[model samples]
Target: MLAPVDDVVAWGESLDHLLECKTGQLVFENFLRTEYSEENLLFWLASEDYKKITSESEMKAVAKRIYAEFVEVDAPRQINIDCVTRGEISKNLSQPGPNCFDRAQRLIYGLMENDCYPRFLKSDIYQALLEQQ
Candidate 1:
């Protein structure tokens, strides 16, 4: 279903390229949705947004929101991460900062790149898009 011409180009290039392009990222997000793994992309996007927050109050607010939604145990969209990383995030949450989620963010990024991205490339949706091109 990801038929945007510009995005199609990057989709066929590589996962790294696709992740870097907004259009391609959306397509990938949709693909992840079909697999019930949209949280991976959502976590990555939230991290990017978190880095852009300049206000202290805003940064703490977004940090807590992201942690509660994606990093905390039993979180609605909790991402799979090691206990150490999760523990670090939990400790940081007590004094939430702009960089509190950095470790967890990196772990999620790697999970997507190494796990989901490969499956996405081989998915029927991706193949269909290639055929269309």
Candidate 2:
């Protein structure tokens, strides 16, 4: 992971742009890891995956797993979300749909877009990469 990344410049375009690019996601993910707040990105990623399930049964199973791993109270990698958002996700658990995590996902997206992403652009890691590129 230490290799100098190409196309680093494109990542600064926007959060969506960064998330969409494979290399951008890695760079951003590594940046988040250093801040010890990788959970937000991880949750956001799980939400994306949850949205792609084709079957209702499969989607429900993945939803519960996503909740257990990320949304539930005391989840091992519990994301920083408000009780209302958390409660909404909890309410949808039993008959969860693909969009069950939508609210929490949007909230986390806002957190990353407004907070973490800015710092990432300013981080030594990103700066050094820019210098390399």
Candidate 3:
């Protein structure tokens, strides 16, 4: 059963606010999975982790791994970014930096905010969580 409309609205306020909370992010990710868009969140999370690497070699390795896993053509989790962003990332590969994926990350973030976020707010799972509370 779903929660009261007011309850769900009160809990989330907005998708951006919801995403700021750990539980909300988990719920949002689960919702993304239903639409086969989970990679958006996964890539965002990976980029966050990638930015934390302190060692130059480690940063380069992690950046390469992220590209292979998420940015490369035909990557298992290839995100829906434009060629220009992809080209920028490819260029950055020569001298990997923590900011290498920043442009792509922002694009993905916008995608989620404009596309998936509204759907998640309406998903049964999100309402169910509110009902439980």
Candidate 4:
């Protein structure tokens, strides 16, 4: 659902609030693209999706895909993360658990919260959305 004016205003109050709203995520994704940091947001989104998997085979396939796309060395859309976190994820990719990407997700979420969310609130894109409301 699209966020109302009040919900848009609330997006400024916390990154969690913004992420929880689909419209907010789209706007934020747009903002992140402009900043050339969309990879982090993509990884974060994928991790959230990974948590909802039910089929074991599907989960394993997704785990491999996520690893190849965002976690592996020289991944096409690699997210910025410490070696320790990357190493841990790499080691666990074989097992493919639901929470396997938790650490990397947290790191990316924190990066967005501290570095991107503030800018998003102040951005013209976001401001225009608020203006329209």
lDDT of 4 by residue, 12-114 (tens): 8899888888888898998999999999989999999999999989999999999999998899999999999999988887788999999999999889988
What's the CA RMSD for each of the models? 1.8, 1.8, 3.3, 1.6
CA lDDT, every prediction?
0.85, 0.87, 0.84, 0.90
> In what order do the candidates fall by lDDT, top score first?
4, 2, 1, 3
Which of the predicted structures, 1 or 2, would earn the higher TM-score when compared with the native? 2
Runs in model 2 deviating more than 4 A are 1-6
* Tens digits of per-residue lDDT for model 3, 1-56: 34445545654677566655566667678789999999998899899889999999
Each prediction's total of clashing residue pairs, residues at least 3 apart in sequence or on different chains, is: 0, 0, 0, 0
Clashing pairs in 4: none
With candidate 1 superimposed using the best TM-score fit, by how many Å does residue 56's alpha carbon deviate from the native?
Answer: 0.5
Candidate 3: residue 20 lDDT (0-100): 59
Best by lDDT: 4
User: After aligning candidate 4 to the native by TM-score, how far in Å is the CA of 82 from where it should be?
Assistant: 0.7
Give the poorly placed runs of model 3, Cα more than 4 Å off. 1-11
Better of 3 and 4 by TM-score: 4
Candidate ordering by TM-score (highest first): 4, 2, 1, 3
The candidate that achieves the highest TM-score relative to the unseen native structure: 4
The TM-score obtained by model 1 is 0.89
lDDT of 1 by residue, 21-81 (tens): 8877887898899999999899988998888888888887888899889988899998999
